[model samples]
Every structure is written in structure tokens, then in C-alpha cells.
Target: MVTIEPIMIKGHFFTAVTVCLPKTTLLTISNNTGYIMCGALDVGLLNSRLVDRKIIAGRAVGVKTIDELLMAPLESVTYEAEQHGIFSGMTGVEALLQMVG
Candidate 1:
């Protein structure tokens, strides 16, 4: 199953997506500029192999839902995310705000 919905954070509009697979679910919240995702995201690949894309994203481990992903501290972030002031240990919400700002 796949679910996608609009989300409002501090008056900013974003999209939340949930995809249920056989054994796991993938969760992510995104705005025009960047996104935060569950552990399935590969921050290392974004930073190294896909560095030229300049993808601004963060990953939070042990997150089962979009809400948890939004509240959890980021386990890792892309280099582009770091350029935007989003860092490991930052809450997903905070990183998102930084991405927008």
C-alpha cells in the first residue's frame, strides 16, 4: 500500500508519503527544497556517489511512521544538507526548516 498526504509544518506545506512493503514500510516527508526520510534512505550514497545532484536530505533510524521521522534526530544527512545547515543529531523538523530557510 502507498499513502501520500499533505502536511503543514509551521505554516509551511509539505508532503508525507508512506509505502508499505511485505516486511517494512518506507516513510518520508518532503518540501520543494529537501526531505527527511526513514532509515531506508542512503545518506552515504547521496553524499558520495550522487554528490553532484546536491540532494538535501536527512535520515532518521528506527522510525516507523512519518510523525516519528519528523520528531526523531537525524542519524545522517547528505553533504548538501550539511551545506544547508542540516546536520546529524538535528531533529527532522529543524533540518527541514533549515532547508527552507
Candidate 2:
């Protein structure tokens, strides 16, 4: 697993990570607004992380290769995420909103 410190992107602060397995790779990104998971990572895995956090979390799809994960379009999102106007098919970078919380 490779992790990055929270960095500013599209006006939001996000911590990006990539996990490599024997046959697949997964990406996880999170910010004050929400979390986004790509590849085979399960959204349920984030429940514990969300218990004390007010941010939303969702899954991103449309990725045919690991390299495309960051730019891939969203496939499913949580209600809180939708409130930010992040919808299915929106790119990860485009879905992010400035942190206000």
C-alpha cells in the first residue's frame, strides 16, 4: 500500500492511497467531504472509518485499468455525497468540493 498525505486538489484536501494485490490494485481517496474507493475495494470496508467522521464515502467505477482510477467516473455514491452534486459518471476530481467542515 502506498499512501499520500492530504493534498489540495480542486480546492479540497484529499489523502490518496493505492493498494496493490497479487492480481488487482485498489485506490482510496478521502477528504473532509467524503471518501472514494476504486477497483475492487468494498464500500462497506469504510464503515468503521465513517463512524466518527461526518464525511461521505462512495465507490468509483468506469476504470478498465488501474492507471485510470483517479480519472475514472463515479459509479455509486452515498446520499451525503450526492448533496455535494457528485453523481454517477462524474470524474473524481470533478466531484470534489471545497472543504467547509
Candidate 3:
């Protein structure tokens, strides 16, 4: 079993440092606002969700993961306008880490 700890440091961009114990793995994920991306995303999964170019930010820094972010606690941010939480359990992202790192 894996434990999930979602943390939020900024809002302009959503950043999370996911730590997996027992396995002793760590991932630093930075994604745009609702416009998000990560270093731990899946190419195939992202390709499957090919949306619009305008919707996807060009400043994607990390790898693309099929895993969706686990929603960070509302207390993590002040953006009430956003419906989708910034951070959450990213099953896909975590799996990618397991495979890659």
C-alpha cells in the first residue's frame, strides 16, 4: 500500500512534492493552475486526452503523467473560482515514478 501526502506551496503554479515511503521514492511535480502539467505524467494518457492547444499551457516543465493529481485541501489555496482542486492522489503519476525512478 502507498500513502498519499499532497502539499501546496504556491497558486500561480501548483507545485507538489510527493514522497513514497517503504520504497523511498520522491517526486517534485510542478503544474500550471487549472492549466496543469507534471514531470511524472504519461505520454500515452496525455495523448488520449488531447484537448485544445489553448487549454494546455506551453510552459509544461515536468513529464506528463496519466495520473490525475489528488485534490489538495482547500486550505492549500484561496482560489474559490476553481472547481477542480489543485492537488490530489495521482495514481498515474505515482505509477510512472515507480517505473521510471
Candidate 4:
């Protein structure tokens, strides 16, 4: 089963998605512009190598499971994100707010 719901944080609407599989649930939270604010601790996100010409802030969590990523502390971030004052060890929500600011 998959569920996607709208959540408001800091006056911004975000999409929260959860896909339940046989033994795992894939979860992610993103802003309206499709910038990933939080996601599972997957290699695709953790050690992402994709580089774009535009400087989009990206961040990853340090959870062992997908669900834990929801509240997990930030583990890594892109250089552009650093310029926005987003840093490792901060919560995902904190990073998002900083990015919006």
C-alpha cells in the first residue's frame, strides 16, 4: 500500500509519501518544488554523485531504516546547502526552514 499526504510546516506545504511493501516501507518528504527535504538512508541519496549546473541544496539522513529517516539527524549535505546554513547534525525540518529562509 502507498499513502501520500499533505503536511504543513513553517507555512509551507510538503508532500509526505509512504509505500508499504512486503517487508519495508519507502518514505520521503519533499517540498512543493520537488526538492527532497528528507529521505531514507539509501545509497542513492547518501552518496549521491549526480551533479547539476544549478546549485540545489541536498541533504541525507543517518537512519538504518526508512521510517527512522523521518526524525533522523542530517548526516550529509551538498555545498550549496551549506551556504544556506544547513549543516550536518541538524534535523531535517531545521534544514528545510533554513533553505526556505
Computed on alpha carbons, the lDDT of every model, listed in order, comes to 0.93, 0.62, 0.31, 0.58
Candidate 4: give its CA RMSD in angstroms.
3.8
Candidate 3 structure quality by residue, lDDT tens digits, 1-101: 33333443332324455555473343434444233334333333333454332222211222322133332211121122122322223232332232222
How much is the lDDT of residue 44 in candidate 1?
88
Q: Candidate 1 lDDT, tens digit per residue, 2-35?
A: 9999988888889999999999999999999999
- lDDT for predicted candidate 4 compared with the true structure: 0.58
Off by over 4 Å in 1: none
- Lowest lDDT sum, 10 consecutive residues, model 3, at 72-81
Q: Which stretches of candidate 2 lie over 4 Å from their true place?
A: 41-55, 62-67, 98-101
lDDT of 3 at 65: 26
TM-scores for candidates 1 onward, in order: 0.97, 0.66, 0.26, 0.66
Ranked by TM-score, the better of candidates 2 and 3 is: 2
Q: Residue 10 of candidate 4: its Cα lDDT? A: 74
Query: Each model's RMSD to truth, in Å?
Result: 0.6, 4.0, 13.5, 3.8
User: What pairs collide in candidate 2?
Assistant: none
Give the higher-TM-score candidate: 1 or 4.
1
**41 Cα displacement, candidate 2 (Å):** 4.3
- Backbone N/Cα/C clashes per model: 0, 0, 16, 0
